[model samples]
Target: GDDMAILAALGLQSYRFSIEWARIEPEDGVFSQAALDHYQRCIDACLSRGLAPVLTYHHFTLPLWLARQGGMTSPEFPDRFARFCEHATRHLRGFDIACTINELNLPLFIREPLMARMTSEKALARIAAAEAVLHGSINSFFLYSPREVILNQGLAAHAKGRDAIKSVRSEIQVGVTFAVQDEQAEPGAEALRDQRREDFYGVCLDAVKGDDFIGVQTYSRVVSKRDGSSGPEEGHPRTVMGYEDRPQALAATCRFVWERTATPIIVTENGWAGDDDRRRAAFVPEALSELHDAIAEGVDVRGYFYWSLLDNYEWAAGYGPKFGLIGVDRATQQRRIKPSAVLLGDIARANALGADNRSAAAPQVMGDGAPVGL
Candidate 1:
């Protein structure tokens, strides 16, 4: 497909993708050999393209067979997850780096209010219907499940899943990725900011201490004010997702995650969703420059991958977010390589930053919204 070719054209060394559990095991205890073979071919494709295949075991999309049996709340949750891992490891070959799960600590509660307003009556009714179908219990997916249950079940799943992968292929480097933000404390808001950071990243960061690496997915900088409200700074440009255009956030999160866990880091996801390709081109270099600073300061930062290679469907937001380096012609499915892709490709090919990128990535009062080097 042109998708893999587009990424290779961007001179990227690796491509990270998650195998769909539902596609592999649509029914309970049912394994699809065809699906496994398909994924093996995908791995081979990446390898053939000279791109390393980085695999993620899970990415929020839980198999309905498991969800119907009480989702992550079921006592068999961890064991079931381990079973899938064992089969995947044994059948799917060719990825040395993998993530047990992606963004296990997402703050879904904050979006419920907005979703309620945006949701149609039919959608709300479907929720009621699903609950009734589950016998008046939690029928919602694990993403919408109770936070405590997610935390507990999540920890267990990672432990068992990691062991399952290692038991089958001891050489595979395994870890979990977390959605982290650059948590900034406004004047008199230090304690509140610390608490916010703890609520979002503390548990997951602490759990992956012994793993080979921890993946950090940071996009924007968030400020915690004394008034208990947090958001982007007033004057900065914002992404379509309403996040501030602060590329320095990547560096801040890298430092935050490394200082806490001391584990090796890989930036699994970091990019904004917006229509401004120019901003994205500028954003990429600045963010990577910030990340390079962290590496120079003794952080064991290994690699980084942009959020996506194509403008694909963004969960909950659909296909609106243009976070891709290659734009897709909707009707024709033709690929349009944006300037950002060329810029990144040149950087990748040279293994060095150009003078223009270096000048553009210079610090500009970005640190904590005050004057400091990014």
Candidate 2:
């Protein structure tokens, strides 16, 4: 499916995409002019279609040479990242928003079994295999590679990277996005919830205070118990990702993150992951309503970019979990525009949802040449 044209057709105001660090800088000190030109074209493509381009510099991947040299733990990581950012931004002349790194908090792939989806022994074996392939303990956004050192390096990298991008495109709004949740507290769980919250987001939020904005990516809520985050509420609907279908979590998260950082908010991602197009169709309005209320209350949300435009790979989770308005048949490269696509497009065209400004419109098919779109 054509993402840029789809966004324009939907009448969405902006598009967010990542510039591949690995592709632009395949080797240390060796940058690709072709890679720079490719992303420059991508930026232009969005503008050519009347969509504002919101670019993310790093989205959980890195060049191989850097990974082989201890990855994020390498003493050279931050500077190398900044160097790449400055050089890349020079080619990217017109984009206005830049996220320095995506999801710098939560440690979503923190070697934890739930996220890694690997038993401990198999995890170790795969880690071994990673070492074999990269020649160093790989740190290129693996499902099991988020660690204190890695996140700490990311903090430094974000600072330097933000500066580098701003140095070239100072007019651009620079920021970082992190995974967030509603973080509801169960009985006697307030302390535990706050503790978990700090563990996941506190440090990163502290660092983001002065940035132009903070991107909050929330899919569901976490009902934290005294001991730990509880399983999804027993009676609530759940998504294929095994989380509660609480679209209102976006509101809770936006309020909390804005209170914490005082930076402007942009919903970097929020969507249900499943094959049920109705769930997505219903989810968008509920989430947007929540977001609308948050905005009404002055959370200062600048944008609400849905998690995705097409169903595609979901990191370690593979392609099983779907969170797209359009579905693709992998074998055919053919795209199926889901009902949710029309639903969201209608809301986008109306520029509002819920009872006040509901409208319906069919989706206009976009081109498929773009690597990723949202």
Q: Which candidate is the best by TM-score?
A: 2
Q: Please, what are the lDDT tens digits per residue for candidate 1 over residues 307-352?
A: 7677778877888988887788889988887887777777766555
Where does candidate 1 stray beyond 4 Å? 108-123, 129-138, 141-144, 356-374
lDDT of 2 by residue, 274-356 (tens): 98788788888788777777777778787777877778688868999998777889999787877877777666666667467
Instruction: Candidate 2: list runs displaced more than 4 Å.
Output: 114-119, 139-148, 227-229, 358-374
For model 2, what is the C-alpha lDDT against the true structure? 0.76
Q: TM-score of predicted model 2?
A: 0.90
lDDT to native, each model: 0.77, 0.76
lDDT of 1 at 343: 77
In order, what is each prediction's RMSD in angstroms? 5.5, 3.9
